[model samples]
Target: MDIQTLAARVDEIWAGEEAADARELVKQALDLLNSGAIRVAERVGGEWTVNEWVKKAVLLHFRYSDNREMTAGPIEWFDKVALKTNWREAKVRSVPTAIARYGSFIEEGAVLMPCYINIGARVGAGTMIDTWSTVGSCAQVGKNCHISGGVGIGGVLEPLQASPVIIEDDVFFGARGEAAEGVIIEEGAVLAMGCYVAGSTKIYSVPEGRELPPGRIPARSVCVPGALASRDGSHQTYAIIIKKYRDERTDARTALTSILREGI
Candidate 1:
């Protein structure tokens, strides 16, 4: 079925309507997701558009499927979703302990180093998911981005209306950085290590001496963890400071070598 028809079917299933081929329909949606034919969210006309129906399909899958045992070498597990096993065909290089669940699309030329990618996520080509990092369910990461070690890119399934985290192309997310609650790290942004961003996290633009919109890191920004005094002048709270835009020096520091992206 085309995306339009699939979307309608997913909506119907989500509404508790019984379709004789409900499970099949859900499987088709997942298959599309796995092949990168569809995404839970994508940029259209320079704005991020969330596909609520796709998210609904993912939720419906959990309800319709049953958990079972799965084993990989000495690793035995029981789960509702299956792990992806097509690294060679996908042209993705995955180091030991790297795992990506079924229904996630990992484009060719990407490298996974002891990382975890959950269902409904889409990782673009030439990206690197570093050791101990996690690309959460439904999070959309674009091309040539670096998800550094121990970073957490948040995902959302419940509240079907909630948006998943979006990390655009050329982003350099430093080690231990966390982006959650539908926060958008725009293209070419460089986040320093340990930076945390959420829907309500304050983002102060140092150059402008003003606060930018919450939940968004502007393009080409160089951000770091910071603190600001509360409105009441009573206490300090965590914040993200946009120190400057990325420059040649910044690019050199965060450069992702082509050699590292090559070969299994």
Candidate 2:
């Protein structure tokens, strides 16, 4: 069935009454998710849009699911969602203890190093989710990105209408950092360790020499933690763009590594 057809079925089943093929529809939706045929959200015309129906289908899946016990080499799990087993076909390198829930997609050349990927999340090709990092529910990560250790890419499921976190291609997230609450990290940006980006966090631009607006970090930005000093001598946490790349052909990794150390 087409996405629209599945969407319509989900809406019909969600409205108080259950359809005779509700389980089958939910199964089809999850099957698509497992095969990487559909995503929870995508960028269109430079703007990110939530595929609400897909999220609805994910929510509906939970309603139809029940807890069951699963054993893996002495590790026992009792959960409604089963772990994905198609990594070999997808060419994803998942280390031991790396956990990815059902209804999520991990594309080719992606490495999961003891990380956690929640439901409805889409991790793109050539990306690396390092140890202890989390790709939260419905979060969308783009291709060739490096999500460093202990990072958190937030989910969007509670309100059901909220947008998921969008991490664009070629981005690098340092250890222990968080990009949450509908924040958008554009392509080629590098976030230093301990940096936190949320909807309300202030971002300062170094090349432009001003404070950028919240929610979106511009493309090719090299961001590091900074202190927004108050006039009365107090300070608050913030991210500063220490540098911005003009071309992808440039040696970004070396430049970013040097730039991130400038503030420290």
Top candidate when judged by lDDT against the true structure: 1
CA lDDT scores, all candidates in order: 0.93, 0.83
lDDT, model 1, position 205: 96
- Model 1: C-alpha RMSD to truth? 1.0
Best candidate, TM-score: 1
Candidate 2: tens digits of C-alpha lDDT, residues 1-264: 888888888878878665889989988998898778988888889788888878888998888999999999898989889889877777888889999998999988788889999999999877889899999999999987889999999888876648899999988888999988888899888887888998988887878888889999888787888867655867755555555554554445423332221211
TM-score of 1: 0.98
59-86 per-residue lDDT for model 1 (tens digits):
8888878999998789899989988888
Query: Between which residue pairs do clashes occur in model 1?
Result: none
What would you estimate as the lDDT of candidate 1?
0.93
